[model samples]
Target: MKSLPRLILDIAEQLPEGEVLRSGRFLHLGSRSAVQRALARLVVEQKLFRVDRGFYVAAVDGRFGRRSPAPTRVVRSLANALGEMIVEHGAHSANKLGLSTQIPVRCIFLSTGRSRELHIGKKVVSIRHAPKWLMALGETGAGDAVRALESLGPLWAADAVPKLHERLPEGEWSALVRARGTYPSWIWNAIQAHMGG
Candidate 1:
């Protein structure tokens, strides 16, 4: 965040949703390449958008249009940007990962870290902390991997659990479980049992 220029800061602080950085030339001093470079770098760094041409926004700001991220990419990035208090727990990983059969206009999740509201790429993500006791039977992990588990759905244990277990440490399972909340009891139960508690 220290590398950010004051102008980039200014533009981001001003524009409406869906407006790109290049569109906000409040200070007409730099070359197109320079501005593009700044904007492009933010995008690549997940601070902005190399996601497309002539388009940019803060990665944590809600997204719109037809752009489709690799599932958990947006959520994970949001988690890192949001600080450590929020642990991706306000909603079920499956829904967040786009693996569930249903889609809430708002992106809801479960979090043992805190309770709050977030709008990610046009989808609203809500987080509410749960009791540490409830999490005893859940699993948590890196955002991309977590979304992968969600993408796998109820059949995920068969298709994804082994791979996920391989990627995560033995302790990560507890954080994820704590984040599961009260959705899809059957699926949650199966995952809890498969994980051995």
Candidate 2:
């Protein structure tokens, strides 16, 4: 019979690139401690990249030799594996919407999952817990507008409405209108004033 480490490696090789591997995935092959030791050994051998506590991903061998997957791709795969919603932070959304001139200094994201940090190579990505209303629109342009408005606050957000109305697609504008009830009174009032309601 193949050893636990060999069996774990065989399974890891079959996973799609950037797919997250957890200790539980290998538990069927051996005891928890044994599986953990096998995983650690694989990481040490450079066969796997440890993303965070209990999370590992196989390294891709490319023309440049070997390298880890892109941070965004890894995060997306992780979100899918954990069944969580992860979206770019409000600061990024605000900048993207031309509602703010300030650029975000860090790679921050808002997530429905618990807040945590993930280290991928030299970069550290932050995932912060956000309120459900803020995430209700998902990753659409309407969602981006919502997050941008929140980041800009009522005063500046009000000023941004005309520009948004001109540039935003009709469908996205309607989405914003539909979600108006979930926003604060001040924000809704600002949107209403600009929208002639």
Candidate 3:
């Protein structure tokens, strides 16, 4: 049988750049501790870049040596690996939907999985656990709009409602209406106003 290190390398090479590696994937090759050690050794050799405690990415050569994968990509990879529902936090959602002008210094996300922070190169991505009602919207534009409005609060509803009414697709408005009962009173009122209910 190929040694643990050799087997790990073989598997990594087949994966494209920015693909995340977790020790659990190679546990069959050795004990849990041994697999972790082998993965750590690979990182030490500069063959992999550890994005977080248990997440790693291929160290592909770039213009200035090897570059860590983009923060968004790493988080997406992490979400998939953990089979968790992850979505951009309200501030990011507001900014993306053109409802807010400010961009947060650090990118944040709401996740159904355990809360954690990841450093992807210079930028930081935060994944925080949120209420199931908030996450029920899933990772769609409408969901983002709902979270954004919730974060912006009731004060902004007068103006935000019209902007959202224009930006959100008809289907999203319907989805928002369907989920109205789950939202806070303020948000639900705004949704009501927007839908003319």
Candidate 4:
């Protein structure tokens, strides 16, 4: 029979790019220590990239040679694996929605999961834990609007609401309106005042 490390390498080679491999998944193949050592050996051999504690991903070979998967792909795969709700940061959302002219300098995401930094190759991506209400609409445009408003705060959001109402699709606008009940009083009041409630 093939050794555990060899078995792991075989498995990793067959996985899709950006697919996350949890250490727990290998428990059935060997003891915890054996699996840990096997994973570490693979990392040293440059066969796998360790993304976070207990998480690993196979390196992809492109024209530039071997490299970790794209940060966005890794993040998306990781979020799906963890069953966490992850969305663009409010600043990014604000910029995308034309509520702000400044662009975020770093790759930042808001998540229902704990705040953590993911280092995929040389690039570092930040994931911050956000309030549930901010993620209520998921990845939709209406959700972006809500996050943009939150990033802008009460004063600016109040001013931006009219534009949002005008710019957003009718369905997205209605979705935003319907979700106002979950927002804080300041945000809800701003929406109510500017949107004519």
User: Residue by residue across 1-197, what tens digits does model 4's lDDT show?
Assistant: 99998898788879888888999989999999999999999888777888889999888989989988877788888999999988889898889888889999898999999999987777788999999899889999899998998999987978888888888999999998898787788877887898576
TM-score of each: 0.33, 0.85, 0.86, 0.86
The segments of candidate 4 whose C-alpha lies over 4 angstroms from its true place after superposition are 1-3
Provide the overall lDDT of each model, using Cα atoms, as 2-decimal numbers: 0.49, 0.85, 0.81, 0.88
Over the stretch 46-65, how does candidate 2's per-residue lDDT look in tens digits?
88878878888887778988
Give the top-scoring candidate (lDDT).
4
lDDT of 3 by residue, 86-193 (tens): 888898889888999999777888999888887665567788999887888899777898889877888997678789878989999778778877778888887677
lDDT score, candidate 3, position 154: 83
Which candidate, 2 or 4, would have the higher TM-score against the true structure?
4
Between candidates 3 and 4, name the one with more favorable lDDT.
Answer: 4
Show pairs that collide, candidate 4: none
Local error of candidate 2 at 145, Å? 1.0
Q: Return the candidate ranking by lDDT, descending.
A: 4, 2, 3, 1
Choose 1 or 4, whichever is better by TM-score: 4
